[model samples]
Target: MLRTNIFTAWIYRLQHTDLSSKHTAVIAELRILLIDENRQRAESLTSALNNSRYKISHLASPNISLLKQVDEIQPDIIVIDIESPSRDILESVSTLSNYNPKPVVMFSADQNTDTINQYIESGVSAYVVGDIQSERVKPILDAAVARFKAFQKLKVELSDTKQQLVSRNLIDQAKRLLMKKKNLSEDNAFKAMRKTAMDTGQKLEDVAKTLISLLNTI
Candidate 1:
């Protein structure tokens, strides 16, 4: 009995250690899509992030086919080095955010509040306004990844909440239609819908949507 207990304790400790290790793992060796028009700045950034942990892919500027490149390369993160992030660039980044979201670290010379806000609203994760050193690159990237994770979590929660609200509205509308058309009480209306859903082996939302569509057609 004592040996079994010790073995159980050892297993628990191993699991606890593994959880800690996973937390530290955070982001893996990321495939970075580095965008910089200036050749000199690009070279400097390449040298700075020349570590085994990062596989850097370089792009000169935001082109018409930047989205195509993103689809193909599918980099974990995007690092942009530019004098001032243009409206065109910000729009392209926003497009990327909509389709395939990823952490974006933008280093720009312009310190204008409007530009900074635009970058953030457009989904740029880390916006460094001024010249940043090579030594600061890794830390900045790590921070961006962390922020992106938090933002993504918030987005998921918001989307779920919105979906729930829409589903509730749909069910309520369907119930109202049934009550008026069938001359049934509220509880009876609900039971009727539930029975239909169960009989058809369909989701409540799907059943509600179908009822609504039929009612609308009439």
Candidate 2:
């Protein structure tokens, strides 16, 4: 019974602990760009975040140069509150995703499935459909940042995989060319390419590309 009570107390402390406070300096330095069409709700949100130590810049709409604003401000995160997102807003968000690529958190009253999917496709890290309460803001933003980092890591891994596949194909093509033209065995051709790569202090992929370029011309 005593062990159970101690375990329960430890779990409660863990659940109630504010882990974000450990990174208070980092959190305090984050810049948040807020976009909301409704002034009243924007004010409410700003008030709720007043003590959160985040630097915020509010914009009424993305009708202006949204790209320029993002570039100039260079915010760490973007928070959008709207009833229903317009086509222009999605376009702007898409542009940001392509060029700027900041973590985006969207709060909307629109419960349509298509609209929610559109927002996600436009690079919104977190899409909340309901009222925006004061206590939910920080947690939502933290989740958005986490999701964005995870997505970026996945993208990099995919890109690396694609490059590796291309390089492997190039190396195979070069090896086959050597086997055919130089009358070398398959293993010997690969060894010759590897030796040239090491001697020239260049990548095997680069040497493969050079071999292909020269052998194709001959």
Query: Candidate 1: where is the Cα deviation over 4 Å?
Result: 1-22, 61-68, 83-90, 93-98, 110-123, 183-185, 213-218
Q: TM-scores, in order shown? A: 0.69, 0.74
Root-mean-square deviation per candidate:
11.9, 8.0
The 10-residue segment of model 1 with minimum total lDDT is 1-10
| Model 2 lDDT tens row, 6-95 | 223323433443474355565446788888887777787788788775678988876666657777888888877644354346446557
Q: Candidate 2, 92: how far from true, in Å? A: 5.0
